[model samples]
Target: MPVSRVASRFAGIEESPTYAILDLAAELRARGESILDLNGGEPDFDTPGHITAGGTQALGGGFTHYTPSRGLPALLEAIGDKLLKDNGLSVDPARQVIVTPSAKHALFLSVMTLLGPGDELLIPTPSWVSYPAMARLAGAEPVFAPLSTDNGFRLTRENLEERLTPRTRALLINNPNNPTGNVLTATEAEAVAEVARAHDLFVITDEIYEKVRFRGEHLSIAALPGMADRTLTVNGFSKGYAMTGWRLGYVAAPEDVSAQMLKVQQHTVGCAGSFVQRGGISALTGPQEPVEEMRAAYEARRDLLVEGLSGIPGFVCPSPDAALYAFCDIGGTRFADPAAFTTWLLREAKVAVTPGFAFGPGGERHVRLAFATDPKTLGEAVDRIKTAMERL
Candidate 1:
């Protein structure tokens, strides 16, 4: 029998390119191909022993039951203290924070809570692949405001002004952004905040990579005056604490919005894992030496990869100041399409990288190389990339 007709909301959505490449690499590796995977966004470091021990203690203490829809009070309090200490932002543990399965889930919750059919979300181009798709899933239109390579992919006040419309309901900002690794300055962030305030739009800021900055400090738009009430800040332990498998994230928003999001969470995920929440408590309260060590390693890899890629003919490699990615331009070269170039590199160089076209329209001529792998693997991948460029 034929299946029931699928919903129209899913018509425009497609598989995530990051995972698609990962699957392909896994298949090729199963066939004995020496694949060097640079397509991942996860850090290579293992979760800290203390964090793992905390999870173990929770399990042994028989704390596996369902938690409150919002989160454990202790975890929320820890997160509140962390926000104040790290980002200079204040949040009420009982009213403002809701722990979710992951930051990706937090984004979905924000969209569902604040958006609907007639609403619009203003997103910067060459952004994380899920932003527009998530907006579509929530029955909102996603309007693109393209950031230029000439501007280091940083959004400006003019960029925000040009994209504002009557239906614009929110603006999404990802600092130390994915794929592009662009971190906005405090001045630029305040300018964007000004536009959001003028348009009366909710600002959903993803600071998942806040701890991954290299050249300068990380700033939060939520900290700006008049923004705390309108901004929903989403972050988690995945990127910063090497806890991707833990699937722990949280959102801090105005009390009223946070209340509504708790209802959504009750019907949806119900709550993040209880034991995992315990581990998250430790992640927030524990010593941050592991975080710093991981960041230092990523910095070294970034330097090596950027320096190596810069030597390739017909390639333009920009030094990323934050995040663990090096987005390179491959236009005016032998390759014509980013997707095609990625496929060719995987087959010829046995190195896996993400195609830039998956990021957004403005990423068509570029590709993203992850520096989250080990130094030895990254060095080998660079050598292979150089050889591949020579072949082209």
Candidate 2:
């Protein structure tokens, strides 16, 4: 009997490393083992009451039909206002916004629209794992651009220019970056915009973690002069509004690019859920106290985990400026790599964490611990890590 085979393009990529570790942690919990999870990146808080109430109201009002291929006009207008008021990026609701299932989907649609055979995308190292895979899925090659740790994981004009090729079609960056949680300074962001203009390249700025900052102000690269036309701004409700289960995200791009991306959206997943989008409208326009409360809680957890790990021998925990993660260096430890150390830590300490290599190069001998949990849990995980270090 002949068996069906998967496509050739998918053969090169594997599952997301973060979720794989999460599955292992789940299995341990099923077996009645006491496992501490520091691997998942989701916020522990629930969606606010007002937002859920909006969804309920929409359902009762018979808002279950499919919306416009782009999105509901009211939601689009609200997002446009949000981009202008909060991000300083002005966009047209009628032609520049498309609500999607998740931020990840918005990214995939953008990649497919901008990249094709023989095109290349510049992705900074230690980025979220999905960017490279999305590029490959669009039949484009992903080129890695190395960032300096001493420079606080920012992309300098020189390093970015060196990686540019004639085939380069676009550049992608995540502000308040994943894993490292380092926010780009105003000067650094201007340098990136300058490089993009000089090389005539498009930019995709993922500002999903913009609201999770602790010490720096969030600015959109698209707001810079001449960048609004060439940059695609991606944001959503998952991280900022604690509405991950609702799965709502959106992209603001130039009119033409938005049209192309709509074609992709029209064929797949058509439109974001009607009721969920109403919930998103409430999330954007309603009271923001819940968002602030969640941010404050994450900050406390971040401090607890980072402070506790600082005293562990051979471990160096940097103070993260934003996001719910702490990417620590384990280079001083005896382990050969982060994967080996993670395996040992899980078996001996009963704590699960994401290995650094999963992010990209420049992440060797490091691990990313998500602090999106309660303070007591984070404290316990820290103590367990200390004990595991003593054994090592």
Off by over 4 Å in 1: 1-4, 18-20
In model 1, the clashing pairs are none
Q: For each predicted model, how many residue pairs clash, with residues at least 3 apart or on different chains?
A: 0, 0
Could you give candidate 2's per-residue lDDT for residues 46-154 as a string of tens digits? 8999999999999999989999889999899999999999999878988999999888889998999999989999998888988999999898999999776676677
Q: lDDT per residue, candidate 1, 8-52, as tens digits?
A: 899778888767677778888999999998887888899998899
TM-score of decoy 2: 0.97
Per-candidate TM-scores read 0.97, 0.97
After aligning candidate 2 to the native by TM-score, how far in Å is the CA of 131 from where it should be? Answer: 0.5
Task: Single out the weakest 10-residue window by summed lDDT for candidate 2.
Answer: 3-12
